[model samples]
Target: MKVLFLQPPMGGWVTWGKHIAINVNHAQLAANLREWYPNIDVHVLDCRALEIDENTMIKILKDIDPNLVYMGDALQTTGVAAIHPRYKRAADLIKSNLPNTKICVGGFFYGANAQNILEETESFDFIIAGETEATMPELAKELSKGDPNISVVKGLTYRDNGSVKMTDYRPLIKNLDELPLPAYDLFPMDKYVGFNYVKKYVETYHSRGCPNGCLFCVGWSNYDKRGKNDWTKYRIRSGKRVVDELEILVKKYGAKFVCIMDEDFNVYRPRVEEFIDEMNKRNLNVPFFFMGRAPYHLRDKDLLKPLREIGFVCGLIGLEAVDEETLKKLHKNVQVDQVAEVVNLFRENNIMSVTTWMVGYPDDDESKIKNRFERIDAIDPDMMALQIMTPLPGIPMYDELKPFIQEWNLEKWDFQHAVINTKHLSREDLGRLAAWANREFYSKPGRIQRILYDKNYHPLCKLIARCYVETADKHAQAAMKNEVFV
Candidate 1:
């Protein structure tokens, strides 16, 4: 049996000058399939990196001529709502050329509503309804046995005599350690790029799932789609296992930095301690970074020094908003003071902090927007990600904002641009406010010079810091031109 996996072209996520990333989930899927079915041939085609059009992709599919082709829709790609058009175009072309081949897709996007996805797109033969690690291997074995009636297979949605039907939900993988390290070999690792902070850093995961019920996030919803309503089911790999992967990335792949793409890294203190200790023992000199809740870092303050000693150079934190009322509405469980403290703490530890904030909430007016920017300026994170509040589907705000969504274009849904307006601000006005916030925050006297000349940052970081201002200027220019306001 032969199987193929594809990362579809990033519809609009990168066309607007955003970073292009390797689909780590697809790499994991390839690893899962290859581990389970050693005799079955497995291959991956990253259309996004290759910049191949639908016709070229169709040709690649024809040349490979696999029995099954799998595609995925991950949250990092701004959900399938943005990529569905590209997905359908590729699926249709594949079906037209290879009618006998089976097509399957899985990831946060289809896993949310598998039945509806299948009903809407006949190009797909099946959809994996949950995490594919457990489901894909089992489905492969069943298909090898020639079992046409795969309703017995859990975590699948498929067409049945012209009607859509879904199988039972698959349980979440409780033991993340059981899964093999991602098949980074299957991807064009050198082509991957990130923001100025972690540019070209290799990706790995120490944990999965987030406990926070932030209204604007879809991480928890992904677990909910699998029927695991408990958000606290945040799982982690053993610290030793994580260190082993880190060693592999550094020694084998020559990774200068590793980015743990977890939803939140500071969920469990003891696990972090173990990781720090293991990394120290291994003397893994590679600089790395991770993301987590802002308050969690302060609560685990003792771990900061050790984390820094273990070559932790940068951290990504989501402050969301600075006002108490907005934080409460979003259920961020973090305070404005906590946000300020976290920034100061990272700075004190000599670690670069990239803080994120959102604008265009329901009650937000021009005054509130300006106030938010004022708060961010006061806090003064090393880097800032000012985003417009988008009503991405599956989040609680989606239903409320659906009625008012001004632009139906999926490409506009990337967090960098706003697709909806606040009660007082138009979409164009929101864009202007966002652009102004970027300019004002970075325009602090000597801020750019300090970052560039600071001896604390990694040499690679300094290289990026020198050029980041130009990137920010480009974004600001686009906003001023109102190019992305629509």
Candidate 2:
């Protein structure tokens, strides 16, 4: 049997040159499938990497002549950011061209609602829910056996006649070390390019599941399934296991830096300390980056200092909104004051910091939007990314505001689009506000001066800043016409 995994091209609104939009470790999924059926030939088709057109993709599919096709349903290119419309369009095209091949869909979309997704698309023969490390192989074995009934397969959703059936949910993997290393060797690792902040870096995950129950987060929904308060529901690999992978990447693959792509790298304080201690003891001096919550580092200033001393260069922290009410609505536990204090701490320790904020929340009015921008200006970090609030599928905000959604087009769900109706502003009004905010923030003389004087300034930062300025100007021009509004 032959199998092919496809990652479709991104839509025009979300395209970013030649880089893949989401940077998931799909090698892990492919590697797990290979382990289950070693005799079966496996291949990956990164549509973004090849920049394939419809005709090219159809020809490739015909040439591979796969018996089974597995495509990621996750849309985001580098992170679990948002759904890309191209994936949906590609799935439709694949179903039409490869009617004989059994198609399977997995990733964030199916993980959230496998049965609904399978029914809605009517494209996938099976949907793998949750972690695919164990379920994927089991599914392959059953398919190879010519099993007609798929409902019996645990952790999968499949069509049964006209109805959709779902098996029992699978438990999260506890012993991550037992799994094989991702088959990075199988894909074009050399072709992968990191963004400016991670130019010399490769990405890896140390754990699964987040303890934080931020209401606007889909991750929080997954963690809440355990039904525990403050459900620190994370499962991590041992420091030895982590270091072992690092060693392979450094020595064998020529990886000079790593990006710990966890939701919060320092969630488990004691474990992180142990991991950092081990890294220092072994003299593994590779520079790295990670994301963290402001409150976590503020409570342990000493802990952050050590991480900085041991080669941690920067951290990306999500400061969703500056106002207390907006923060509460988004279920971000940290206060605006805490964000300011943490920014100062990181600055004092010589660690670069990048903060993120969201505009266009459902409850936001013009006054609220201005207030949020004011907060951002006051607590300005080394760098910042401002985006419109998008209620992604499966998030609490999505369900709660479904009736109020002004736009149902999947492509508009990108953070750049204003999809939901605001209490105080029209979609066009929000677009104008976003353009004005970007222009005011980046074009400010004080902000420009700070960027020039910053010791850690890099070429990538300049590129990103330039992109922001260009995007802002483009939006400003469109806003004047009032015809480009979503």
Candidate 3:
């Protein structure tokens, strides 16, 4: 049996210029398939990182001629997550070019719309509806036999006699540690580059599933069938295992920085503490970043300083909004003051923090928009990512906003682009305001000086700060000229 995993090409996130993070999903799945089914030939084609053209992808498919092609959705919750809708076209092209090869897809987007994908695309023979590690191998083994019974395979959707049918739901993995380390050696690791924040940034998945039930998030929706809060059930690898992989990445792969791509890194303090202690003991110091909620940072205040000692110099902090009312509407459960406190903490500890702001709420008007940015300016985060609010499917707000969504084209769902206008703002106006907010936050000469000259910030962080301003200025200019997005 032969299988090829692909990370399809992406229309780059509009907020930043062309850059590709490592497709950790592809690497991890390839590792699992290789480790469990040793006799089966496995390969990966990372079109996103390599920027492989369609011609090259088709040629590689023809050359390898694998029996099955697999891809992942990167666990997106919104239309924005459905990157490069070209995947449908690519799959169609592959089927026409190679009639016998089958395609399978699984991830956040696919899992959410399994029946639709299976029904819509002739190229997609199967959709792995849950975590693919355990389920994929079982399905592959069944496929090896003639006329496999897919009904036995849990968390799958497939065509049955010209109709889409789904199998029983699969349970989320109880222990994430059971999964193998991603096969980074198989990837073009050298080609991977981080965002402006870190150049040679390697992504790590120490945990899976978020514990927080943010109403706008699709985290809970993915596992909705499994029962409520199933999706929010947090699972993580041992800290030793996490740092052990980091040591390998640093020593073998020349990783300058590591991105802990957990939904919530600090959900459990003990795991974080263990990882920190392991890093200290091994002296496996390399710049690292992770995403954390505001409250957790407050809870783990003491340990954060030592984390800095281990090269934990930066991370994304979710200051999703400036006002308490907006935070409540989003079900962020984070206080506006807590948001301010955490931003201050990161600053005090020399940790460059990236925060987010979403415009276009129901109550959003010119005055509200102005006040939001004013509060943000007062808070003064190291970086602020501004986006027009997009209510993705499965979120509570999706049903409410669906009728008002002006851009039904899924590809434009990228957060940077406004898909829906608020009751108070037009889509174009939302885009303009978002642009204005970016300019407002980063345009000051004093702010620019602090960003570049802050002795507390790492040199790479300084570079990121400068790059952010330039990008925002470019977007602001485009927005001012009435462009929906830069």
lDDT by residue for model 3 (1-486), tens: 888887666544545443466767778888888888887788888876788888888899899998888877443311244453656777887898998988887765566667766787778899877677777777776776688898898888888898899888788788878888988888888877655445676778877777776766655434524445565678889888899899999999989978787878888889889999999899888988888988999999997799888988887777667777767877787887777888889988899988877776766787889888898788778888776666666556667777778877666566776667778888878878888888778876698788689887877777767668767865554445533321
TM-score of each model, in listed order: 0.91, 0.87, 0.93
Clash number for model 1?
Answer: 0
Report the Cα lDDT for residue 221, model 2.
25
Please estimate how well model 2 matches the true structure, expressed as its whole-model Cα lDDT. Answer: 0.65
For candidate 1, the per-residue lDDT at 99 reads: 95
Worst 10 residues of 2 by lDDT: 13-22
lDDT of each prediction vs. the true structure?
0.73, 0.65, 0.75
Clash pairs (backbone) in predicted model 2: 21-77, 21-78, 22-76, 22-77, 22-78, 23-77, 23-78
Hey, what RMSD does candidate 3 come out at? 2.4
Tens digits of per-residue lDDT for model 2, 1-486: 777877766532221222332234467767777876787788888766557778798789889988777766322333233342455576678879888888876665456656666777776788776665666666666677654556666778777777888777776678777777777666555555444223334678767766665666545322213233222467777766777767666666776556676777777677778777877777776766777888888877888778876667667788888878768877788888888888888778766666778777777788888888888888877666666666666566767766557766655555665666687788778878877776777776677555545666433444444444445554454434432211
Off by over 4 Å in 1: 11-18, 51-55, 73-81, 196-200, 224-232, 463-468, 473-486
Model 3: weakest 10-residue lDDT segment is 75-84
lDDT, candidate 1, 269-323, per-residue tens? 8878888988888888788878878778988988888898887888878887877
Segments in model 2 whose C-alpha atoms lie over 4 Å from true places: 11-18, 21-25, 73-84, 196-201, 220-232, 456-486
Best by TM-score: 3
